[model samples]
Target chain A: EADIYQTPRYLVIGTGKKITLECSQTMGHDKMYWYQQDPGMELHLIHYSYGVNSTEKGDLSSESTVSRIRTEHFPLTLESARPSHTSQYLCASSEKTGIPSEAFFGQGTRLTVV
Target chain B: DQQVKQNSPSLSVQEGRISILNCDYTNSMFDYFLWYKKYPAEGPTFLISISSIKDKNEDGRFTVFLNKSAKHLSLHIVPSQPGDSAVYFCAANFQGGSEKLVFGKGTKLTVNP
Candidate 1:
């Protein structure tokens, strides 16, 4: 079956280290998004891409950046990781057609910066 | 400030009972609402949704109720089972130029067998 995938289900990196979280989808969706969530907390949208080479920041201000070189891949990168940046990063993809299109999410990457 | 709010952080219910999860939003412009279920170590999956125009929508054992006047929405799961124990999130979209969603803090449900 078609699904979205995220690598490094868990990551523990030192502060100030640069890290990249990988997200890929097999569904060929044009819209992809990245959300940050603390444990047992609300999800905050950080970055999103309408399509290849088109990326925009979401409602939340995030220090991380994202790139959409291919429709199936949307990766998030942090220049210098901080303890505050440690959280679960979830990747999702959805088709922009109807009014209530459902989003398919990846398992998510848990990052811990010490 | 949180635009969407799920006041209940956790809920417990007995098996075969009904589980009602509630969500409230401040943005009246939101036209679409969705409910998602998530398990540990896994991503959230779409459970059900309702539009602003619809008062209610049902799928199998899950039913979503939308109250536009109160700016509130709820998900009701009848005959709650042990497998139904997980975190549920409510999301709302303005449905304007950008369809970015505003999500509420999830509520964790535990169904005792």
Candidate 2:
């Protein structure tokens, strides 16, 4: 089935270690987004890409960075992980048109920095 | 500051009863709104949506009501089922090209059987 996918559904790493979270979609969507969320809390958008090679920061200021090399892949990298970075990272994709365009989301990556 | 707000952190409803979830927004620029349902260890799934121009929209047992003047919206689920227990988030987006969404703190709904 065509859907968004995120690797490393669960991760536990020491603080200050470098880590990368992978996200890919098979629907060929032009718009993709990354969001950070705490359990039972609001989701905060951290990064987004309009298309391949076009990336932008979202409302939240994040230490992590993202790249859109191909239309299907948008990966996020954290140079130095911290305990505060322990949260769920969600990846989503959507079409450009339509009112309230529905976004398809991946299962999400739960990171634990200790 | 939180642009969207879901005041009730959690709610409980008995099975076969009506369950109402409310959301309020401060930004009038938002013209489109959506509701998403999320379960443990899974990403949120789109439930329903409504445009600012429309007052209500319905799909199956899910219905979304929007009140532009009050900058408020609500989701009503009739005859709540145990499977309906999950966290529901309300999100809003503007009409411009960016289309970035502002989301509210989710409300956890528990349907007791």
For every model in order, what is the number of clashing pairs?
A: 0, 0
Which lDDT value does model 2 have at B48? 91
Per-residue CA lDDT of model 1 for A1-57, tens digit only, reads 339999989999999999999999989889999999888888899998889999999
The Cα local distance difference test for each model comes to 0.92, 0.93
- What is the TM-score of candidate 2? 0.97
Which candidate comes out best when scored by DockQ? 1
Work out how many backbone clashes candidate 1 has.
0
| Candidate 2 DockQ, CA atoms | 0.70
lDDT of 1 by residue, B1-113 (tens): 99899999999999999999999999889899999999987888989989898999999999999999999999999989999999999999967648887789999999999
Model 1 segments beyond 4 Å from truth?
none
TM-scores of chain A, one for each prediction: 0.95, 0.95
